[model samples]
Target: MSSPLAFDPARMFAVFGMRAVDSAGFDREVVQAPGDDLRCVFLWGKDCYNCNVFKQTAMLHKDALLDLGLTWFECNVYDDVALGQRFSLHGVPAFMMFRHGKRLGRISGWPGLPQFTEAVRRLRSGPAAPPAPASTQ
Candidate 1:
């Protein structure tokens, strides 16, 4: 088994086997670059409890997620303050979806594995984003 995370961003990326990107990468690769695959950018922060939970739970199933055909990248909002601001992110463990260098949608927290994956699936295949839960409306 892999070592447990120590709340360090680099360790977290290595542990989760996720590609870590900075604001420059986000702007260049995500905002400007074109791609056929749908993209999901995971936004996380240091020492975030929910982030750890999602990393251990939802992110652990990323191989299955990849099979569903969306590309994934992660960013540490704690280090990339500009990235957080650019997305208007209010919390850690969020998801920012994109398609062909355009914004698609965002999910603000770990909303359980099934729901989150469903959202990702819908975003990748359909034109509409998953509707906000009634509680948020």
Candidate 2:
């Protein structure tokens, strides 16, 4: 894959109307440490077929995001290497949820709309952090 920094945010926003960020933008303000709105970051690869499909799916459901007062963005892992590294991206077409600058949840690959919405609902309702690791007795 190409360097993640290579993706053009201008072009991304122009084409998708969804905020697309490079490493610089990613670090600047795309995520809020103590943010008020729920942020959904979609990580994709330019050459990934699944990413293309997910893009369409996301667009179709964008109103749902807006109604939920969610902020959605797309990042090309190929162009934003640092962001991908930060998220430890395992594959393309992954969706991650964030709020208050904290990651709430992530669901990899498209699991269909019903399942996807359920995941989003869970993310919106769940605590910012997962429960602490259990102690081994």
TM-score of each: 0.75, 0.70
lDDT for each residue of candidate 2 in 10-129, tens digit (9 for 90 to 100) = 343444456776777775556644556777777888878888676566566656645666676888898778888888888888888777666777889888778987777877677755
TM-score quality measure for candidate 1: 0.75
Which portions of model 2 show Cα errors greater than 4 Å?
A: 1-17, 127-137
Q: Which residue pairs overlap in candidate 2's backbone? A: 4-79, 4-80, 4-81, 5-79, 33-100, 35-100
User: Weakest 10 consecutive residues, lDDT, candidate 2?
Assistant: 7-16
Lowest lDDT sum, 10 consecutive residues, model 1, at 6-15
Mind giving the per-residue lDDT tens digits that candidate 1 earns over 1-137?
55575434344355445677898777787767665667778899877888888776654675665576656789889999999998888889898888756788998898986787788777766654335568854
Q: Please, what is the whole-model Cα lDDT of each candidate in the order they appear?
A: 0.75, 0.71
Model 2: lDDT of residue 11: 47
